[model samples]
Target chain A: MFWRKLLNIDSKIIYVVVGLALLLPVIKPVGMPVSISEEYTRRFYNYLTDIPKDAVVFFDLSFRETGEAELGSSVLPAFELLQKRGVKIVCGGQWQQAPFFMQSRLEKKAEEIGSVYGVDWVNIGYKPGGTATWRAMMEDFWKGAAGVDCNETKFDELPLMDRVRKLDKETFAAIVIWQAGTPGSGTWMQYAPDIPLLAVYMGGIGGNARYLRSGQVQAMIGGMQQAAEFEIITDCLGDATGLLDAQSLAVLVVIAFIVLGNISWIMVKRQDSLERSS
Target chain B: MNMDPLIMLEAVGTIAVLSYVWKENAAYRFFEFTAIGLVAAHSIVQTWNNYLKPTVRDRMIGDGEWYLLIPAAIGLLYYTRVMDKKFSWLARYPISISIGYSIGYSLAYSPRPFLKEFRNNFASFGHVNDYIFLLVWLLVVFYFIFTLMKKTKKTLRVTGAITRCLIMIYMGVLFGTSILGKFSRLLGRYQFLLRDWLRLI
Candidate 1:
């Protein structure tokens, strides 16, 4: 009876417990020890840090508002890191909201450093075409970007644009994609495989072990776990690091629920068998 | 209390969506509908601003590239699907064009990357882990063989069973990671609610 009662508890109770698990860490400061996973995040961190100054890094912002939670945490730090390195970033995306999301972070970081927009960085906004657009960008950057900035400012006017006229391996030192869905790093890898392509994938889509092994993706930062590692390496404690405690608690709660349910199920099955035998 | 109406709205929406975890109710449905409506409006505006405006202003009128109108006309035929059954076939032209282009483009580029990846898998046999990977990869591939006739080898059957077990383990790990990913997003929302909205943190 106890086993059945335990198994039959209202789902609402579980929901409230999970909600508390997520909420408690935010309300209280518990500095959870975050472990560094070197496989992907370290590689990504090294590539970002080691890139020479005045080198062009193409940041493809491919996430929308919904993805802001996960991708934005890593993105802000990435911009900060790039600014520290004094890298000239050519920001573009396939998603329409990407420019606004990406530019806001870059501008915030640039402001702290007193970096001029047109000189230090340029955002061409979202090019409408997907794969075809990537191919065009590879062929000719100005043409692919439609020769206009996110604000409809001509590319010729931007100082950074003077250097980034095309999208070849030589023209750009590296490309990093903060990606969620299609027209993302996958599209970039297919169109511009020769270039050193790195990606920060949403943890849900971070299942491509083969790509990492093959070096198709030069490096990758996947999910918040990896994002926390990147933050540690950069020595910048940001949102990803702050949220790590909550992530750990939430996972623990879910696992506890799974274990409890399984144990109850087994107990109930055993009771039923004993009763039948009697 | 948060003075920002936007933050207040966001908190309300978050709570409403999260309400589904407790029980499906009108509050959850209201927010869900609002989200869908907002996304629909956003898509329309973006498509107009990002795609239609540029193609018309820059390519067609600005450059006097009248030839751009041809594809535009073809693209317009896609709307015919909503109009009539007979005209629905007109949409097929654009669809076919897109599919054909994708297939051709993928065929041209995808094989080289795949082949390169496959070659690397074979080349990296120096480590003990490399042999395990190769074995798992082959077994998983064998598991996908749908043409297993009655006369199939016993070894193949045994490999298929082992592959299924391996796949289940792999899937479990993937599932765990995905849950962590989703929970990270949830944590982000909670952070916003507590720190930005309620200012509790």
Candidate 2:
């Protein structure tokens, strides 16, 4: 009866427990030690560190607002690191709302680091076209971007833009994409294979392991855990690090629920089978 | 408590959206529709202000690139799908062109990378991991050969079972990662609710 009752527990009860697990840590952080992975986060940092100072790098903010927390955390520290290295950044997006979140964050980080706009960084923002747009960018950057920055300022006006005439190896040092889904790093890997591609995926890092192993992707940071690890390594601790405790607790609660549910299910099944056999 | 209007509005919207998980209600429905409407409207405005407006202003008018209208007209043909039954086929022009161009483009560029990936699978045989990869790859491929499997069902039963297990493991890993992604997003909302809205953190 107890096993049957446990098996039949209301989903809302699980939800409440999970919710508390998430909330408690945020209210009072556990500051659980986060061990950084050499394969994902460290490789990502090493690649950024190795980027030659004052070289241009393209940042593809190819995620929606929903992905901001995970991908955006990675972007902040990456921006800081690149800025510290004196690398020029030119930002754009495949996802429409990508720039909406990223531009302000970049601007804020730039201000803190005393970096100038147009000269140091330029947001070309998002264009509606997808792969064709990327293909056009490979052929001619300014033309593909419709000759305007996010604010409708001409690319000719931005010093950084002058150097980024095309999105090829000669022009940009590397392409770092904060990817949520398709029309992302894969698009770059397919279209502009010549340029080095670094990816920060919101999730599904396992799916992309093949690309990294194949050397199609130079480096990758997978999901929020890696994002938090990145923050620690870069020494630019932010929301991801703060939220890690909550994330860990919530995951634990979920696993516990899964185990309990499975045990209850098995017990009920065994009891029913024994009765039927009799 | 954080009293910022924007943050307050976000909090309300977030709560409304999350409320659906508990029970379907008017607040959830209203907010859900609002989100859809807002995103659609934003997409339209962004496309106009960022892309179409500038192209028309600078390229077509200022730069005297009137020939650009030819492509624009073709793109507009997509809207014909909503017009009338008689002219719905007009949308097919743009659709065909897009599909044809994509296929041509993929054929031109995608093969090299795919070939590289395929070659890499067979490139290394030194490591134990490499042997495992190769064995699993072959087994999975052999399992999918429907006619061959049917012909030698008894002989290949063990191979098929092993391949199925490997595939299931792969799927489980994929599903696990997907769940982690959702959890991260949920944590993001929790962060917002605590730190941004309630200021509890």
State which candidate has the highest DockQ.
2
Candidate 2 chain B: worst 10 consecutive residues by lDDT?
B146-155
Which tens-of-lDDT digit does each residue in B17-93 have in candidate 2? 98887999999999999999998998898778767887899889999999999999999999999999999999999
Candidate 1 local Cα displacement, residue A188, angstroms: 1.9
Q: Model 1: per-residue lDDT, tens digit, A69-152?
A: 678778777877887778888888878787776677778778987778999888888877677877887787887777788888
**lDDT of candidate 1 over B1-201, digit per residue (tens):** 587988899899998998788679999999999989987897787667666787789888989989988998888988999997988989999999988988998899888877877787677668897889888987787678643641468777777778889999889878876777677667777887888888887
Q: How many backbone clashes does candidate 1 have?
A: 0
Error of 2 at A222 (Å): 0.8
- TM-scores, each model vs. reference: 0.92, 0.95
| Model 1: per-residue Cα lDDT at residue A125 | 86
Count of clashing residue pairs in every prediction: 0, 0
Q: Could you say which candidate leads in TM-score?
A: 2
**Cα RMSD for candidate 1?**
2.5
Which clashing pairs does model 1 show? Answer: none
Q: Identify the runs in model 2 with alpha carbons over 4 angstroms from their true place.
A: B84-86, B146-152
| CAPRI category for model 2 | medium
